[model samples]
Target: MSHEQLKRTALNNAHRQLGARMIDFGGWDMPVTYAGTIDEHMAVRTGAGLFDVSHMGEIEVRGAQALALVQHITTNDASKLQIGQAQYAGLTTPQGTFVDDLLVHKLSDEHYFLCVNASNTDKDFQWIVDNTKEFDAEVENTSGKYTQIALQGPRALEILQPFTNVDLGAIKYYWFANGTIDGVPAIIARTGYTGEDGFELYIDPNASEQIWNGLLEAGKPVGIQPCGLAARNTLRLEAKMALYGNDIDDTTTVYEADLAWIVKLNKGDFIGRDALARQKEQGLTRKLVGFEMIERGIGRDHYPILIAGQQVSQVSSGSPAPYLKKNIGLAYLPMSHVAIGSQFQIDVRGKLTAAQVVATPFYKRSA
Candidate 1:
């Protein structure tokens, strides 16, 4: 699709006004960078950065059977979520393949919100509707009605404290609160994709511009930069976070993706619980691991992974770390080859270079 034909976010004009380089991100016209990728990445690490995340899907499941419906469709133990609490989960088919990864937030006993990936929004909504037909849950796609903005970094809380009346200190990680921002009702969650203290604000699309401007004005002194997808990717990679279509896909299983924590085998009978339990018993054949180049090479997506003398897997996502100043990447390989300090070779530009398997999380901020 052409750039002009792609979907635009509520802050599309603002991004353009900032001279951002726009690109196709999952069919949506989104900013790839403003200023520069490395500079934006460092801004989040040292200070705070703002992100327009309105392209994400917000789905609501409400009814008497909402809890039961969510428990059946997701691999996580939804029954454990308290009001205003959120948990990362996965929607999987009966064959144990991932449909999509999502975040389940329990608003009340009969109300729940699911933040899903943008690319799979339509498919996920249809899947939920088709599956919930047997139950009494009412599924609604509220993506178009809301806009999400992420204020992420070490100074995020300080920057956002002056705008809302909510108690920022009381709102712990993975918790949310319904409050007003400049007279507009908003749901603010103390969660973020980057491994830092931040908040995700969900507000009416019509009121997004006001809130964005308020934040920018409030953050002027703290050095809050408007970041784009380029910084988002690098920040997530430093935290060892997974990205869909790169780190995982429909063909990849939870066991192979090293996300077995999302699968609750004993949480009643979920769609993929049985198959995942069986896989656990049989042991995983392949697993994703973190690696760093020992020689001069920049690992990237789809790069070949050679073990001993033969190709075993491929790099899923990688980048030259602006923080670490080294090349790092994630890749899937045989279970027997995924040990700390294990030796391997990565094919960078048709030349094999030595690499070593290392512990994940290339960066972590102080608490």
Candidate 2:
């Protein structure tokens, strides 16, 4: 999409004022970097980095049949979730591939909140609506009601504590509490895309700039920087977090993507449960694997995978992981080639570059 026609987040002005380099991201005009990708990336690793994730979509399901509706669409078991808890789930199609990977939050006995990928918001909302015909639930696309921000890094808690009334220490991972941040009502969750101890805050659009500025001011002592999409990409890549359009999509199954952990076969008659069960029974032919470049080239998306100079699969997501200081990437390959320490080749610009399957999560926070 063109820049002029792209949608802007609530923080669009804030990012421009900070001299961020803006770019088109999934039809949204977003900041790609502030100081630079590498600099912003390192700041999040050592200190704290703020991100405007307001473009992500939110859907609300409310009524007596909310849990039933959620369980019918998502691969994860919604019944396993308690009030105030959240679970990672995949909204799957009848054919067993993902419509989108999302976070399902149990707000109450009869209320649920779904955080979906920015690009798949409308599609997901419609999918939920179409499936709700059998259940007595109300599905609303609440994407515009709030703006989201992520405060990530080692010092994230220290920077965010002063602005909220709730005790930051009490909120466990994957759990959230509605509280006031800088006197603005918000949903504060101890969840993040970066592999660090951090929090993602969902606040009213009108209050986003205030909260963003507040974080920057409060975090100044700890060297906080406003990061952008570029840094976010590298950070998540190093952490082995899947990017919806790249690492996974409608063509990839959860089991084939190495995300079987999110699938609960006992979830009971989900949209793709039967298809997934059959796939499991037959065993998987292809599997997603992580690799580091053995040659001095950076492998990228759509790059063909080869074994002994013959094509086998293709790279899905690849980047030079700044924190790990290595060229790390993920790809789908034959199960025989998915084993750790196994060697393969990636065609980088028509040149066969050596790469090897490596243990994922190239970077992990120190305990």
Candidate 3:
């Protein structure tokens, strides 16, 4: 998409004022970098970083059948999520593939809030609305009601604790609480895309700039950098977090993506339950696996992956993991090559680069 036609988040001006290099990100005009990709990336790994994630979409499901509707749509068992908690889930197609991976936050017995991919928001909202017609539920595209900010890193709690009324340390991972931040109502969740100790806050759009500036100012003592998409990508890659369009899509199943942990077949008849059950019984032919570059080359996204000199699959997500200081990526390979230490070839440009299977979640923060 062109710059003039791209969508802008509430913090667009703040990012630009900080001299962010803007780019077209899934039709949104977003910052690709500020200081630099590596510098911002290292800062997040070492200290703290703030991200404007207002472009992510939100869908609200309410009414008596909220849990029923949520369970009917998501692969994860929403019944397991407590009122104050959230769980990662996939909006699965009937064929057992993801429409989009999302977070289901239970607000009450009758209310569920979903955080969906920015690019898939409209489609996801429509899907939920269609599903709600059969249940006693009301679905709303509540994306515009809030601005989302992510405060991430080891020092995140220390930097953000002063602004929120709720105890930051008390909100365990994957849990959230409704509270006031800087005296403004906010949903403070101990969740983040980066595999770090952090929080994702949803607050009024008008209050976005104030909180954004506040977090940055407060974090200044701890070297908090205003992060951008470039660093965000690297951080997530290191942690093995899947990127929607790249790491997964409608063509890939939860099992094939190595995300079966999120699939709760016993949740009782979700959209893809039967298909997933049959697939599990039949066994998977291929699955996503992490690989490290054996040669001095980077296997970028969509590059052809070969085994025995023939194309088997393509790299789903590939990049230089800044924290690990190595070229790493994920791809679907035949089960025969899924074992660690197994080898494959990634066709980068016109060159066949050697790669080897490796353990994932390549980076994990110290507890």
RMSD of each: 1.0, 0.9, 0.8
Query: In model 1, where do residues sit more than 4 Å from their true spots?
Result: none
Model 2: colliding residue pairs: none
Supply candidate 3's per-residue lDDT for 217: 97
Q: Among all windows of ten consecutive residues in candidate 1, which has the lowest summed lDDT?
A: 90-99
Q: Report the C-alpha lDDT of model 1 over 180-209, residue by residue, as the tens digit.
A: 877888999998898888999999999998
Residue 205's C-alpha lDDT in candidate 3?
A: 94
lDDT of each: 0.90, 0.92, 0.93
TM-score of 3: 0.99
lDDT per residue as tens, model 2, 65-161: 9999999999998898889899999999987899999999999999999999999999999998987798998999999998999999999998999
For all candidates, what are the clash counts? 0, 0, 0
Give the runs in model 3 whose Cα sits over 4 Å from its true position.
Answer: none
TM-score to native of every candidate shown? 0.98, 0.98, 0.99
What would the TM-score be for candidate 2 when compared with the true structure? Answer: 0.98
